[model samples]
Every structure is written in C-alpha cells, then in structure tokens.
Target: MNIHKISAATIARTACLLLALTNQLLSACGKPVLPIESQTVEQLVTAGITTVAALVSWWNNNSFTAAAIQADAEYARLKQKGE
Candidate 1:
C-alpha cells in the first residue's frame, strides 16, 4: 500500500484551525490569553496561493515550449522544400 505524505500547506492550515480552537477554549475558561499572531494565517494563505500560481505557470511554460518546438520543425520542413 502506498501512503501519500500530507503537504505543508495542509498542515499549516490545520495549525491555523487548531490555534483558533485553542484560543476559543482558553477564553471560555478564563485562562491566561495566548498571543496569536495574525502573520501565521497570512503566511499560510500566501504559501498556498503562491504554490498554486507557480504550478499553473509551470504548466503554461511546458505547453508553450512544446508548441514552439513543433512549429520550428514544421518551418524547417517547409524551408527544405522551398530550396
């Protein structure tokens, strides 16, 4: 059986959820408040978004490269006939 490792982005988002739940529990109990940095959530969102954008960019580049190569090959074949 093959097991897929969970991604960092998923872990980060899970941590964000845990942080929220922890704070809620703490506040309800009247315990000492913990400091929750907004940066953690912001960074996680940025990481997830940038990862998706990069994958899309990579796909576009690979397809464009393949098409360019095919066009070059066709151009060469036509040039040979014109000679």
Candidate 2:
C-alpha cells in the first residue's frame, strides 16, 4: 500500500478551499464575507479541527483504494508468473 504523508501545503490548500466555500455560502445567504482568519479563536479552532478531519477522511479513503489496487496488481503478477 502506498500510503502517502499529508503535507502542510495540502492542509493549507484544503483550509483555503474550505474558507472559500464558507464565504460563498455566506454570500449566497446575503451575509457578509468573513474570512477564516477573521473568526474568533474558538471559531478558528473549530475550523482547524474540521479541516483536519476532512483531510484525514480523504487520506483514509485514498489509502484504502491504493492498497486495494496494489494488491490486485500483485495478484495479477503472481498469477501470470504461475501460469
């Protein structure tokens, strides 16, 4: 299984995406745009936790898929060799 490590850059990118989405949703509701950094400390922590959870979920799903693909390839190789 090729489990890749998540980088700071990845986290930052996801955070930015989440921020943009939040802003868009708020704007759609006739609300003022509030950037993530402008939020209170509690809000910021909540956002950070949310972002991390999303990233972890994504990583877990991808890792499982990768492992499955790797296993399939190995099985194919072994079967071909046996044949």
Candidate 3:
C-alpha cells in the first residue's frame, strides 16, 4: 500500500502549467494565437509568466511564510468571487 500527499498549491500550479503548455503549443507553432501578431504577444507573455511563476512557487516552497502568504492571497481571491 502507498499513500500520496499532494498540496493544494502543487495541484493548482500543475493545472496552470498544463494549461499554459497546451496554449503555448497552440501559440508557438506558428498557429493563430490571436487575431493579429501584435495581439499574440500576450499569449507569449502568459507562457513566460507561467513558467516563471511555477519556478517561483517551487523556490518559495522552502519558505513557509512566503508560500503561505501566496496561498492565502489566492484563497481570498477565489473565495471573494465564490470560486
């Protein structure tokens, strides 16, 4: 028997990474990311941000306060909108 423990933050980041990667696959392969090339810049930016965010999240995991603050903020944001 085995037990698997997954934190909410890990799950959230994984989902975000997966979605970003899928969107990047659609955007970076010269497909129509947006209505125009300039507009597609946002998609590229989002891909970059997700990569950075994931790395930052990993780095912050070593710090309880930082990770907790981020998690708390996300929780409050979601709860405010009834998510």
lDDT of 2 by residue, 1-83 (tens): 89999999999999999988988899789784774344585888889999999998887635358788898788789999995
Q: Write the per-residue lDDT of candidate 3 for residues 1-83, one digit (tens) a residue.
A: 89899999999999999877777787778663433476577888999999999999887645359778898889889999999
In order of listing, the candidates' clash counts read 0, 0, 0
Task: Give the worst 10-residue stretch by lDDT in candidate 1.
Answer: 58-67
lDDT of 2 at 82: 100
* Candidate 1 vs candidate 3, TM-score winner: 1
Worst 10 residues of 2 by lDDT: 32-41
Rank order (by lDDT, best first)? 1, 2, 3
Against the unseen true structure, what C-alpha lDDT does each candidate score? Answer: 0.83, 0.82, 0.80
TM-scores, all models, native as reference: 0.38, 0.38, 0.36
Best by TM-score: 1
Best by the lDDT measure: 1
